[model samples]
Target: MSAPDERETLATSLYAHVLALRAAAPDAPLPPGGLPLPRGARPPRDGAPGPRAREAWPAVTTLVRSALADADPVRAALALERELSAAGIRDRHVYAAVAALPPPEEARDRARALARALTRTGTTVTAVAAGLGLLVPLGEPEDVPYLRALGLLEGLGDRAARALAPLDRKAAAVAWLVRERSDALRPLVDALVRGDEQAARALLTGLSTTPRDLGRRQARYIAEAVGLTALLRDGPGLLVPAFGLLARMSEGPEAEIRAYDEALTLYETVADRARELPPLLGHRARLVTLVQELDSGDARLLPWPPGRRRAVLTALLTAVGEPENLSDPAASADWRRAEWVHRTARHLAAVTTAVEAGGRRAGAAGVPPTSRLRIEVAVGDLGEPTGVETRLLVDGRPLVPSVFGSGVGEPPETVLLNGALRAGPQPTEVRLAEAICTEGCCGALYVTVRRDGPHVVWDGWRRPGAPPGLPQAPAYRFDADAYDREVSRAERDLGWAWPARRTAWLIAEGLRERPGILARWGLRRGWISTDFHRPDVTVITFLGPPLRPDGTPDAEAATRQFLRHLPDDGRPPRERAAEALRRLAEEDPRRHPEPGE
Candidate 1:
């Protein structure tokens, strides 16, 4: 078999092994499935009892089932000791034994009662801890106090106790613990962050011994931390696993809000530095869904007024910019680049959808609108030699004011919401919003949909814009219309190859524009197209639209993963491409195998 095929086979096998290990010891910073590692390396177990734990499952399961049912506490204790001893387990690992046994299939109320009893006694046995954790997935409401009580039981000190005091919510407490316990938990987070898969097993096993929900929350937070860490990590291998956990945990409003904060942090961290990593793209894709969720009115922010939250949300979204769709000149300020046109256009679509829904609500209000109820973006985030300016007006009033800025301008969260969303509601106008604020910074996206149902929808209120505002940013500005026109022309001219041509432009235009030789070389190779089946390595990246309407990689998508390309070179594909380009820069064009450059 070819060397590439061998690498693919090895990676696939290693991935399977790592998955099994992750299942067995979830709290460890075990490697995700896609990490490319050297030969014969095993993921560290952090003193985990692999074979011993495996052997103890059946025996421990029987003991736990009996112990859970036995009226005699002494008999249950003895049964646990005898079975655990026979299976080569010890005191520290008693949690693993109880964890191995599934939560009872029925009698959920009884299970909760049993869990509460275990908590009251503050049992040091690992099984009790394991029992406490299983309650969450087994239909327990996951109380903050219970988690705090468990932490105290496990010798979790004053910090953990103090952190859990204010919040009754599970996710909020978890987020806090992620910050406070960075010393103890940072290892697993770091391991996943580096894709090292080292002695994370012990950390993971420690979590697993009786802590499913917190363990899962740790995993989710680890993914978030890793994604933020990816901004400087040189590659995006950690992103897929991180975003996957985020997507899974984001089932409700509180969870979604926490996740949105994480996503925004991730984007703000890496928006300018590393744009093409798969995980970064994945994170962006997730942001679209998250914003959509906030706009959908599933979670009502009862405390905030209508236009207030939506205005903030719109600012954040527009200022943050989309992953695949940034205009040529600018990104956001926190991202160190600002974009307005396409960004505002995106918000326009979201608000228009909400407006249509609001119009339905208007029908209930006995006031029907004559308009077709679609939004029109009269002016986009336009960039020019003179200055940067853009707008999103609703029914002749501003959804957001003209956005144009450069270098470091005003606070971005304020810019997108400057003097907008204040118009009187049309017969069909309905706006829904959720405001998020922290450390004196606040923002949110607003959708104009009818308050059709008695849900927590609000009307766009007349409010003055907040300031400490940003001026026009021209250095990072591009004439978005011109850029789009060029892309459209390429589509008209080349059809399927437009993606390739567009990629070539990115490689040539964007990369070369960087102040480095590596960029120029890589772009040349992209235009040359002499190495489609390049051996050893080829960097796989994507450009243009990410998903089809059906939510698959669009026709233009050609990522290494989507294209069935193999990983042969030990280095990352991006690194490999850079090396290849460096080599090509030295080679003579006359010696080329085949070339169009």
Candidate 2:
């Protein structure tokens, strides 16, 4: 193919993905002409220049190549830099150029330069957002200082949010956090400041996947920020982050203090904001007392009820037995705290039971509940996709997004069923050419859905089972109701078992084995508060004895196994505990491959 034709071919291929995104997420704000969907929102509306148009495809390609093409690449690079500065990053053409530029020595150099220049120059929100798209994926740790500045900005205000709405600031922040892997608080704070659509999704991905390790105080600070985001929204923010904070604060010793502080702050902010809003989001009179009780460190009536308040306290107690009483004797103090927890667990369990019953009735009502939805696509073997995903939920249906354009064949490992990428309208058919991983391998996840009168039947989307994991994605089946059903199951299951080590292991096993049914429970906000392996996995010292093939634990064997996973801290365990742990960790396969064998 000629150079223009080759560029056209690639652009055409990219355009197809864009169209698929448009078709799938009809509700998104489509942009004008052939521009890359800014932050995965807005492609041109119908009757506008579609991607197939001779004029449209080539223009984007021309813009991309012009910025990179060169006989002496550096000269062209300098010229592009001048042009970018002269025209200003705010120019619409800048975004098209930035989003489309093919990676090359010159492109990489230019992107870094541009990110730095744009950051220093203070571009418009759209320009800054578009600049982030280009830089986050390709920019290095050095370029972080500039991007970090953008991430640190507070008070974007409603107007700025609306202005950047087309750019999908939420997704951009998340994409930056995920791809850049910057540990700086700026990024998390930025995402929260903008009130990310699915704040928890971005926050969690960054927290878990980023190479950077964050401290408990910083984590607590983030917890406060997430709660602050919710408070700012008053009536409705992404509830996940707010709830996710409860989970975070519930973890670690003295973490409850952080949780209580965040909740109190949130409660105060919410009370103030609610007064400003049209009407309160649902009465939380009991919630006030819950916060007060926690703040007071009083173990009195425990006035919290069946909602957020109960969950928060349950998670806190579950993390660290109970608050200490300064008046109590030092040695016997542990016993008293344990006794308090024993009592609290019963009350919390009762509350959870009540909530579960109510949730079941609500869920059993059968109609699919109306709510925002986001789609996350996983790539690489990182257990999640890079920001190589987008949310284009049109009328509650996720489209295979254009964000996957750059990752067409990466063999999407998993498509996270949540995260509101941007606000848009809905369309009928969900036409996607994507990959899906199955059974720890990969295959294609191509599907074309159209309505069959009253409902969408995947009869149009009969994707076969895919090979699992990376490289080649398998065709996997999807049930839209899976999220709801899984949550219901988790609630019932969690309620059945108290906060025991066994409960955590079962939850993990449930996720790994029956992912379709219970996977979300492990990762989603309302589910497990701590990351999958936290206190529980460490509680491996707590892992019970050997199990029968039927999977029932053998108490005798469990004690032995517990000792095995447990590392000997400087201090020693009880003699029996030490023996069990040592035996479990050091069991000789030659002597014990099969106890009776």
Candidate 3:
């Protein structure tokens, strides 16, 4: 049968099912199978519409109301369908129009019928989105399957989530979507545990068995759902999963983890629970992670008072046991070589003597026992065939691994000279080297740079999200004055400049001197920068939107203008750059080459 005929049959069947169920038991929850979908071919993809469309299309409400005013039910439905089709998911007012139908039972019933029909048999994602929005206040439990099935479609998860929000069984509906798209996990768990006592317990209980690897962001949501206050109150009642949650919490961004109120109490609770529970291998692995985080001195355990810190450390060490004594041999071996285990053995004194005067051990001369010694970035060939690379040199030895190099799309000047050593008032992390594939795919070496009195401290050493067993750099302290001089000297010494480097340098200098030039092209000066993508050419890059949307020239236009005017030759960089900038300033993009032209 034709698509329209199939949709008509499904709509008719759905109406019959709802009426029969209502007649049989007026107050009973509707069956899951009440609304059957049309079996027609799937609709074409239009990306999910965002709230921007609602902001842009201010006339959406009037159009929707006009559609709904047709007196004949068939024509009203047809008119409403046209509005949804025209506006699609873009016009959110379409949904608001149906929801706001004047509340005579007849008009509301008509709105409900229209929503059900669109949800059941609509061909396009927009129709589905419109249906979902309309149903936000009016959807019955029976509409869930339609929501779930269409929500499983690529672009409909958020729309489905909103529609499900008003239903009694929202948790089940939301959970069904989350299983298919883990991105929606936060809202699901948040909705479940928000202020409801029984629901919080159920959420925690359900999360207890969930797979440990939900990626960092999702795991944090789970922790936030089972918040510190909730955990402190209810944590003792639970066992293993609480430990799992704590372990995940330890791996989160340190600032957020530290913000967990009554942290000392929470740590003590976890330490006590570790001793009480049977030490399964999973628990052991999690324990090792917690212990590792505690020992790292990267701000996790630093905030606690010496007495409290000592007590927690003592409890954890006693509970975790020596790696050699572990029952599982493979697990034992893994823990034996682990960084924290080694650090604990060496600094067992600092932890134990926390309450004692001068108990902190001594380090190499001029360095605190707790702080890693200072290091410096030294430029060297180190085997890359193209541009120069950088490595962290500690005591004249290459400390960072050779595998990390200046990856494509970033220039060495940006990576090393300016970016790495810049210290802010707050502790800041700078990626010293990225994986050959780039920072996103494989991890990068990030050192936290902060000022400590007369010296600048680079202490929190991490290879975040990197695979296990890459070399971890120790923290370093350097004289702030000397560090500044070295960076300045490095900046002035331009012996490393090749053709690509020279071009990038010129563009950077030109932009830095006259920041207003980018504004004429509708670009933010802060967003603009330069990269040496190849040895032969320099590419201008943007950290954010390259151009404003008001019919102005974009990054590509800037790049083309610069490339056409600037050429590699014996001419000085400053001279050539000035010439290029002068020419660029003379042109008017608005009149010559308009937006989208």
Candidate 4:
């Protein structure tokens, strides 16, 4: 019902919220006073008086006292009030309790006197009181005047003072100081010079649209103080702009060379002061041009001690001349005559240093160097005897090995492989092998060798019976020993029947003499051998008259039906024949259903 009572209720709610948070996170630090004061009033003061003695008590003192009491509640009721405040629970009854306190006429004057004393003395009490007034027990806008009069705004760090200023007045205060008190910018300038990045950023942002002269002066002061010639070269913004200015200066004639030289010296100094900045590439190029204009033997044109001169010369040559011939023939003689060799060596040394520096920087930044190789293989038509070749790619490069072979027989067959390779800490070999063959036959074949693991695998040929044009047998696995044994058996069987063809007596006397059988089929006429298996499907063209049983063609029906069904690609003839039988059964009327009956 009353203001004080309402404040108490809010305080109790805040207290309860804090308690809940603390309970949830046991390790969390307890809130100040272990509770929050009421939203619009301060906590009760100790040893001063109860509600019966207060009159016009300062809102800040009241908040501080109440918070202190809640932080150290004497009674369970007080503790409960704190918990309620922390939890944000409000009660009009708390306001009613405040209304019952002594009239303001009696207490207000005394509270002000005590607050003023504390503020002037700059005691912890003043800090607490100021914190309470600014942060809690938010009172009327007029209350801010009363607090400021007590000197609460004096003797605080810029950041802290800014933070403590009334939210609505902070921007206006900053604007007033920047306009009326130009010297106020000194702190900001000093901060920048000291490399206090946060302060410098704040100052720069605050005066973003200010005069360029002021901004440039501020930046220059900082650059000079911090020896940031590079920043000066870079110009205007965050980086030092001196190098950029020097580069601009260097563009004129010989008379301007002195100014350019001075700028370079400053740049070198800046570089020494800040080890991070590299020598300006543009500046280096200009130096090369100057050296080229001068006589080669001019001592002043040279850099310094022999080594240093060599380094400067090398950098200049690198900037202006063609690259060194690393692959030159008459190597020693050519290199001895090469004017740029010394410079090139110096440049290379610098490069090595730069690389080392980069590595160190990366290490410091906690970035790990990457060292991994990736291999990709595309295999096609795996199962068929006329299988597709595999292309192996390593790190996106096509590797062309001088010697590649498949260990299938006495003399290994040359195989084409594709891929790339990179030298590693140890030699890494990537072996590409097929794992399964589902093309010509229903069998698995695997090829293996010891090498680095293949990274990417792809199929170029689709398996038989799969969607047409889709990759089928990407890889196959084969047992080399078993494959060799099978090959040996096949060879032996074919070899044993080889000479049987030459024995005409054995063929005519021992076996039935059938001239037409041999001639009609062309088995004898053609170089046909049992060792080679024909594809299941064949298209035989007859150029002559069709043969009869007696080796003669009947003129009436000379062209007879000569359809020979063979297996499809990758399928055995027997399997094709079985499939054909199924097709025949389905075609028969007995096995078919009448259409639309």
Candidate 5:
């Protein structure tokens, strides 16, 4: 046979011996199957065991089983001991099985005798006997210390606690004594914060039973020491009580408010806080939500107390008005200005109901509407050439005389009006109004007109070099007519089926090119697209109408000139020729002429 085949045969023989030994010791369970026997089980291939020794395995199994079945474990153990001594069964397979039997009362005497014999014989049988001796329960903590020192905790598990209960109880008592002696139990505190959940829970439960002030302080220290502030911010649920403890520890109104604000900054779920807090403090929850809305440019202001409302509005206007605040010129242009104004107006509208309620309350004592009314106007933009005009109209006629100015290296004009006769504040009895604008010419205008008390004010503002001529009437009247004409031309240029769709498409497209346009219209991007369909394609559809009333393009008609090539295939010709165009416009009236044409 080849050398490889010889090795395989020897390994097989060793495995069979291990199995035979396992069968002999019926009381002891075998090790997990499929393990190869140790080196001692096989001799050198050149000096293989004789056939007679191989055949002796079955008789060995029978003898070992008979010896273990003896009534006294001492007798059984001694019998196996004698077999080990006489037969020289050194394989772990034989020794492990003998070790597994429960030790008899005289097991110690028998084990010592075997140990001495094995020692004299210079073999490992004594080591195996000692290991079996240790397995007998001695009920001593000293033995456990050896296990513990070796970090064999995994092997002991709950067994260690039961076996050394007195030692464990003593350890707990000592820990408590340490905590009592030192005010700063740094080790305990560190363990609580970084220990396993069970250990931390046990420590925290003990700590909580301490005096209230000390407990609260300790909890706060642990919370801070663990770097839990950011974690609390992300998940306030875990630290809700911790925040309450912090509040309890804080002193004075400012300190309390600072703590509350810090905690509030960590969580957006203020509704729960609102529900939990007293009514007066519940308002702060709403305020937080309102402030978030404002910061995000929601254009939905809260109708709070005048003082609060004024504070918020003032802050917003100041932010927009500051030269440094206007970050980009393109963002501060006319389009952005219109958006900012519109958003401000909507926000103002949301708060109008509350303002009106407050006004009624002020008028409770029969105060007449004739009280002096004041209107304040503030304009903000880049430091470029910009101007404003104020016009006050009363009873449908001009009230404040129209005034405009330009900046030619001079400061932009700021005007304050009183009851003086610059076209006397049109009497309040007839209906007062106001309009403001950019420049004196008032040819190009951004105007705001409002009726304040019994007088009227009309105002407009423009960039420095706006058109010079001011029409005799309000600019909007003329602009309205011009606007209509442009709309008509745009509709005709783009073959729109209805003016509304055309308008919607135009607005949607304009907003897409300039997102700020939606803010000016007091609409959201979602609302714009929701109200219109295929806005881009619709723009193309309207740019050139394809349908004729009779469902045929009037090729010979002058009025329908723009409809000649309404549906162009969106491709270059070389790749697909005119085939794509022909296919796309097969049913299109503009592409298909009358049958006889």
Candidate 6:
């Protein structure tokens, strides 16, 4: 085929892949490190084009027309640099001006000639980058070597890859660049998804050794590409890197692993391979890390059903806990040993104890082997309607929206930790995701959390007063010890803590558990709400009151107290929260109600 025809064929394939991805997930952002959607003609954001740019547009067009009309490589290269500087216009705008002109059949040869000359001799890095950009619409197979050579220069790979995006041999050129520059993984993905097994292997090798900071930036895109699965079937040479990449993908966010279609299959493969293969340093630590994540409510593993998660965990334990593996003197020298090996052993032992205590098999107790619960605070986007709330992730999926209808957010962390997960022997009904109404009439979903022998179970889904029907959710049974570890871990995670949220939760907890604090002010019922003005400062509002003659809450008569500004103030959140609660308990409403109240 002609070079132009081959370029067109490659471009069509890439376009088809992008369309397939969009069809599969219309709402998701395109994976980073993948083919970028066309950015179109907007000027760069860092600075607007100078006024001289608009004035120079006609001159820029005449220059491009004359250059293409002449079809002389030497003159075209000289005119490109001279005219662009003289016109005082940007290269992108020049490219746009050139693309706008009607192309004659002869224009292809002329344009390619200019593209070659400009790319070959362009003086500045910026000029070379701009020359490559021109080839996006006009690049052909023969231009591949020049693109590859230019791409070898530092920070030029992305631009070279962009020009190569529509050309045949794109995978080979991109794969080569990636081996030299890992940052090129972003564009390498564009080539990998079109059934290029070579590019897939190249990507795995780059991801396996890339620095952690860069690996994280590339993780989600690595997960999105469909080609990596082929490496699993290739051989053990790639398996080690595959394991390394999986460990990285498991970090940061649930979305990274969730985006990967083959996650479960890969986990299963890793587990199966662990029992058969001799332990290597990479395999030992990476497998242990995967298992540790699986144990501590990694979100996906704990909730995985039919015992696949349990089986994977068991296989990992057998692999990592082998006497020969642990006895190695170098074990202590491994940096990740303390992080993964010790923790994994403890968790796996606990899981084993729980499973064995239930009976010979985990199923005997009606609980899966590695099942655990996670109470995560999901902070909605600022200015969005969704507010901060503690949510339940059964395994890795959200339980709130699935059970309660869509219009709900949970109570503060204090309310949930105090009432549900840590509730005593008698089942406790905790207020879960509720309607967003201010008056509190729309009602909320409640779950009964109770202990059943070796398991902690969440059952008895109910939505009282505001609605008659509730969505069906299974009774989640988690091993008691694993459940406790998760709850304790969440409580210690002050990562989510801020002065305002802490104060509001403390006040809310005080009111809910100790009604006398509110009753002392002649207020029988109260509601707690917090507005975080910033990360450090919050406004905790207590609303409730003296009722009207009709026995309904009279808004005008209600006690509206604002603990105006609770700043970080160099105090521990607990200390600050306690002081605010004490002040609320001591203040006399009749003598010192809020000014309007």
Top candidate, metric TM-score: 3
True-vs-predicted CA distance for residue 255, candidate 1, Å: 8.6
- What does candidate 4 score on TM? 0.16
With a 3 Å backbone cut-off (N, CA, C), the pairs that clash in candidate 6 are 33-186, 299-395, 299-396, 303-395
Q: Give the per-residue lDDT of model 5 (tens digit) for 74-143.
A: 4554455455445543333343343344445755544444423222221223222323233333324444
Q: Which predicted model would earn the best lDDT?
A: 6
Output candidate 6 Cα RMSD.
Answer: 16.5
Model 4 C-alpha lDDT per residue in residues 435-457, reported as the tens digit of each score: 23332332212222222243222
On lDDT, who's better, 1 or 5? 1
TM-score for each candidate, following the candidate numbering: 0.32, 0.26, 0.40, 0.16, 0.17, 0.38
| Model with the higher lDDT, candidate 2 or 6 | 6
List, residue by residue over 455-504, the lDDT tens digit for candidate 2. 33332342234432323322333343543343233233322122332333
lDDT string, candidate 6, 283-401, tens digits: 55556556645644232433366777777877877777533334554565443233334444554555456654752444322123334465555443222122466656676455755
Residue 35's C-alpha lDDT in candidate 2?
A: 21
The C-alpha local distance difference test score for the whole of candidate 6 amounts to: 0.55
Off by over 4 Å in 2: 1-60, 70-97, 100-102, 105-107, 114-131, 149-244, 247-597
Over the stretch 1-597, how does candidate 3's per-residue lDDT look in tens digits? 988876665444222433444456653422222223334223322775544544534455555455446555455555655555554434244445434444345566665666676667555444555566668777888887666545433345456656765663333343333433443244334344233545555555556422333443344444543454456556465566666666655541222344344456667888866688675544544564465345432224346765665567667766765445434435553432233343333334343343244424332221122212223222111111232444344432334432222222134566554555666678887766666565677666776889988888777876655676555556677777766544444455454454445665676767777777756655443322223223333444422233346645464643332222233454666666666567556653233332333
Candidate 1 lDDT over 311-373, as tens digits, reads 434543443355443433234321211233334335445454446476443222212222322
Question: What value of lDDT does candidate 3 attain over all alpha carbons?
Answer: 0.49
Clash number by candidate, in order: 35, 39, 0, 78, 42, 4
Off by over 4 Å in 3: 2-5, 9-81, 87-124, 127-177, 181-238, 248-269, 280-282, 292-318, 325-597
Error of 3 at 484 (Å): 11
Which scores better on lDDT, 3 or 6?
6
Give the candidate order by descending lDDT. 6, 3, 1, 2, 5, 4
Colliding residue pairs in candidate 3: none
C-alpha RMSD between model 3 and the true structure = 17.2
Cα-based lDDT for every prediction? 0.35, 0.35, 0.49, 0.30, 0.31, 0.55
